[model samples]
Target: MERLQKVIAQAGIASRRKAEELIQQGSVKVNGKVVKELGTKVTRNDRIEVDGIQIEKEEPVYFMLYKPTGVISSVKDEKGRKAVTDFFPMVKERIFPIGRLDYDTSGLLLLTNDGEFANLLMHPRNEIEKVYIAKVKGIIDNEKVRKLQRGVILEDGKTAPAKVKVLGSDRKKETALVEITIHEGRNRQVRRMFEAVGCKVTKLKRERYAFLGLGALRPGDGRALTPHEVKQLRAFASATK
Candidate 1:
């Protein structure tokens, strides 16, 4: 037997937290009986329903999306804005995003129905590294780059040291692209770090996360992760913890 929320999430209804909310709202049923208790136990043979629609367990699905700018990384939005899920119109299993990227920020984003794997990737204890390519508004100097490499104090406190290097320079344009690697998943961290150094971030694109790299995958395209890749990711997560 499994907790109702876990079963619901496994069945791809929603995230575990959101499944609890659905249970409280009296939208969930087990074996044709309405179940409002959050911790109720269920089994594979038991039938589940949400808002009167019966649900069936499906094979776990995973996808790596090269998210493009202007798309929100969420399952649904009240504002009616375009969301990442809209791109996968035929995906029946309810999947949730692994981490997050700002609405205007673009890069590699993983979507999957494996809640435990998602939690492992997002948990702070894992310390999985994420790399980014950022274009800032000003010509950053070597001193500022060194400061960023050593770590800087943000308004919230000191940030984890980041690996930063200037890729090159466009002196006439007054802009430079730099590569940054960080382990902490702070909100808008790369952008914030640049701001702390008095440079405005013009473009931020994630190039890698953990063992996954956004290799020739163009923007807005997605593909299933290989079994080896998934195994490697799980091993990395376990090793980090």
Candidate 2:
């Protein structure tokens, strides 16, 4: 059984914390009874309500693509830039990216038509971990690694703690390759985080999203998500509660 608030949030009613408040306020009804306890448990078949309204379930469709650089994540760009949809002309349905990868970044990206699924994975409050490999200027020192792990101060604000490991360094080119894992989806966050520490990112590529990985898929290639992966993603989302 899952927490009642998690089920409500998974239904796209609100965020997990917001759903908790709704439950406490008698706004959430489970099987027609208003449940106020935060510890209530629920099953997938349970009827959940919010403000006396029922949430309709939508068909879930998930796709993972190895996105190449220079492609916009949107369906169409107003500036005439190429987009991910151009590579999926046969999939005759509307789908959106879970989060995003910058135009100059390449790697794993998840697309789906299910809004709830997207929100559960993409919401910043969920703190779903994302892994990236970045090439930056200079050798990574112990101080830099500690700064990143302890949370670096950026212009926008202090970044959430990141797990950084120096993979290797190029002495001739004066560059370093590091692997960083973070849970926030701020715009260009990985690159900006490096810049905050005085290293300019020359190449950045996402390696993993939650449990999903790029695998052997080449750039501009995609495939349907397996049933096991989808179930694991749902489990991961619910675990955040």
Candidate 3:
């Protein structure tokens, strides 16, 4: 027997963390009865249902994609816009984007069918770092850099401390290139951080996530995650557990 969330994850329904949410929403079942407890366990002979649909176990698959600008991060969008899932028309397993990248932002994006792995990487408690490069309006001075490194107040709340650095500047264009690293994954966080400093971000791209980099992959290109890379991410996830 194994934990309910693990079963759902291994069954290719969703990530373990999302599985827990499904259970709490009363959408999952073990045998005939609804199982809302995250710790509930079941054997292989047990039947599981999610939203009244049976789940089948399958091998996990992981991929890293160079998410191009204008591509949505979700599996499907109601507006009928192309999404990351559209990039892999032939993938057989039910993989999903680990987190998100905005429609306008471009760069590295991870996709996987392993729910536990997805949960681990995206969960804030794990503190996995992501690096981004942004082109912002105006020059970034030492004071602005210090304020960013120290933390800035946002509409939601004060952002956590970040690692900030100026990369380059184009005085004629009134633009500066900056690199910022943080562990949190709040929506358009890097852009908001710059906005807090009176700078408007015009272009933003994720350079690296954890140990993975964009490397030579071009926009819309993708490659399977190596065995070693998967192992490292698994280690990262298990560390917080």
Candidate 4:
């Protein structure tokens, strides 16, 4: 037996937090009885239902979305702004972003209903590497790139040292494309890091995170991750931990 929320999440009913909300709102039932308690437990033999629809245990689903700019990373936006969830309207199973991608910054984002997998990917101890391609104003010198590699202080504090490399330069346009690989998921850390070096970032897109790559996925396109991919991600998390 396990907590009801865990069962709900494992069954792809919703994220653990969302399942808890459903329980609080009297939307979930166990053994044919409405259950509103947060800590209620259920076994495989127990019958679970939501909104009078029977819930069945399902294999966890994982997805990789090539998010476009301007979409919020949340499941729902309170201000009515477009959210990532709007892209997966047909997905019956509930899921949430494993981590986050800021609005106006787009790229690979993972969505999953497995709470334990999400926890592993999001934990700082896992140290999963995320790679990004950034377009910055003006040409950045090698010395400044070295500073990014060494680490720089942000308004909040010092940032972890990142792997920085100059991808190339558009000499006529006075802009440069740089690649940055970081393990820490600080809020807007990539943009802030470039800003700290007096570079204005015009566009930023994540290329990869851990063993997952964006590949040729176009903006706004998404696909469910294969079992092998999911297993690799879990193994990467464990190895990093």
**Per-candidate TM vs. native?**
0.80, 0.77, 0.87, 0.80
Task: RMSD for all candidates, in order, please.
Answer: 4.1, 5.3, 2.8, 4.8
Residue-by-residue lDDT tens digits, candidate 1, 1-241 = 8898887776666768888999999999898889999879987888999999887776678889999999999998999988888778889887778888888789999998877568767878889999999998887999899889988888777888899989988878889999999988888888999999888899899999997998889999988899889889989988999
Residue 193 C-alpha lDDT in model 1: 94
TM-score of 4: 0.80
Clash pairs of candidate 3? 15-115
TM-score of 3: 0.87
All candidates' lDDT scores?
0.86, 0.86, 0.88, 0.89
Q: Candidate 4's residue-wise lDDT over 18-102, tens digit each?
A: 8899999999989888999998988888899988988777558899999999999999999999888788988987778888999
Off by over 4 Å in 3: 10-28, 31-46
Give the top-scoring candidate (TM-score). 3
The clash count of every prediction, one per candidate, is 0, 0, 1, 0
Tell me how candidate 4 scores on lDDT. Answer: 0.89
Q: Residue 147 of candidate 1: its Cα lDDT?
A: 87
